[model samples]
Target: MNAPKLRWVLFTAAVTFLIAVLLTSFFKEIRKVDTLAATLDKRMEELVGEERKTQKLKQDISYYSTPEGISRLATEQFNLVRSGDRIYKIEVTSQDNLQ
Candidate 1:
């Protein structure tokens, strides 16, 4: 409890407190950066998925430009057939409708 000894002890305690404060702040900043990086990584994955879908749609559009692809789409969507194709029609009864 001498004056010189007391001064040295007080200085050491202050330095320790300052170091603790700086370390706490540094760790907090690092955690924030880690969280932001994770968020950015999730967004990048979503963008990659959208890019793949866009590429697939573009390929489909290109396929639709061809003559055979257009004919297939017309047959599927409009039920159109080529020349000399026969058509059959069926009548549905109320009992068959329930079944």
Candidate 2:
């Protein structure tokens, strides 16, 4: 083959290989970006869930700071009652005890 023709062929092959390598690298980078985006979306969803939990906790704090909520909690947790409140007691026997 002529020298010019051979050089032209070699240049073309080199360019084609370079393009293939670049395209492969670009695709790899694109795949990495897609994976990172998916991970970011998952993290964002987790953050939103945590934010909701935080909001609910804030609401609970607000409610528990109120007098009515404090009274309910006191009654439920400590079995406390106001003045003049009546208390009742009941007893039951199990089947084995009855037998």
For this target, which candidate reaches the highest TM-score against the unseen true structure? 2
Question: Which runs of model 2 end up more than 4 angstroms from their true locations?
Answer: 1-4, 83-99
What TM-score goes with each of the models? 0.74, 0.77
Q: Which ten residues in a row have the lowest lDDT in candidate 2?
A: 1-10
Candidate 2 per-residue lDDT over residues 74-97, each given as its tens digit: 988999998898888788878997
Model 1 residue runs over 4 Å out of place are: 1-4, 84-99
TM-score computed on alpha carbons, candidate 1: 0.74
lDDT of 1: 0.92
Best by lDDT: 2
